[model samples]
Target: MSSAGVGCLYGVGVGPGDPELLTLKAVRVLKAAPIIFTPQATGSKDSLALMVARNYVDESRQRLIYASFVMGGTSDGVWSEAAERIAGYLLGGEDVAFLTQGDPLLYGSFMYVMVKVQAAHPTIPIEVVPGVTSITASASRAKMPLVSHGERLAVLPAMYGIDDLRDVLARNDTVVLMKVNRRAMAAVSQLEADGELSRCVFVRRATTPREQIAFSLREIAPEDIDYFSMLILSGKKGQV
Candidate 1:
């Protein structure tokens, strides 16, 4: 596709943790895009998404836009404001690339931007590049298969209550729980009570050097995990 004349909106996914796994198309787009946007959680200055995209950015030709996300504030007017900022640049006929860690559409800030930007300017051209998600990276690092044969997989944020997860766990053959912060232990307890403990595996800092994999959930407990950790449970006992 010729990325000329049109004000293109590129939702670029940087992949999970590792820099080398980035797709060639993502790299080329990052290098050629006239403007790049990296969003930071309001208070933080350095953005992990930008750090990964920096490996391919052509500093001479591209301008970086730092779009900050409100941390504690209500989402009342934030979306419209962010959309306006991005629209301002895009309307100027600039190819703007929004850098996001992992797939842009998967639980990412890029989704928010894409929704609002498109709502504000329907004619703007938007392009999305898929990146290796943490679920895949974590599963690979743990040397575990996410799905096999006719098994189904379900992904839930740990932010969902233990009761919600219990229902999902009972139904899905394979479950991937992301954003398992401090509630790790509680989730583990519930899973263990359901007699699914042995089927569980926990991966911390997936695909990175600090990665950790544990087959026994009881041994490590939830308190030891960081915010970046993910928990996977396979329905069949011997599968993982």
Candidate 2:
């Protein structure tokens, strides 16, 4: 389904907060793409993806576009509309570089937009540029190895049930709890009850200037509740 001159869409993962962590391939795509698309959480004018890649983007020659989505979820046809707009650009023969905070295929808003775009324009070529994931960055920043020597590693959402989380801690050598939002305190409480809070490594804005890392739940402050945070539970030598 290749069109004569249809432009290829690029999903560029900007990396986890730290601009310097951005890959060379990602920077190249950002610089070459004519249109840059950044996702913004509803009610937030700032786009974290743009912030991370601002230094690399040729803002003077390139166009910047923001697509906002409700972090909780959206019933409105927001994704549909965004997809239409992106397809329109592609049909016009302009390459779009969709910037994402993390890897586009992993919990990135680009994933949703991707489904919509592909459904409408399957012929339009799309390339995903991989970047450093938050989980990997968190481990590196904390100097902790997530898994080694055939150890099991599991990642769960913050909204998972306490019973399920308990099972994860028991079954896996390392468990990562991603996107600790308003449930941050409750997650800590459950981990404390399960005696895994002590071994837990918590990080907010990993690899960024605002980064905060805590080894114990007791060390977490009230302001530490962030939707960008992640909790990693790993025992010594990668045994939970």
Q: Which predicted model would earn the best lDDT?
A: 2
Clashing pairs in 2: none
All models: lDDT?
0.78, 0.83
Per-residue C-alpha lDDT of model 1 across residues 29-102, encoded as one tens digit per residue: 89888888887777786877887777888778778878676643445366567678888878887778899888
How do the residues 141-163 of candidate 2 rate in per-residue lDDT, one tens digit apiece?
99988989988999877845666
Error of 2 at 6 (Å): 0.2
TM-score of each: 0.87, 0.91
Which ranges of candidate 1 are over 4 A from the true structure?
A: 1-4, 70-76, 159-163, 219-223, 235-240
Which pairs of residues collide in candidate 1?
none
Maximum-TM-score candidate: 2
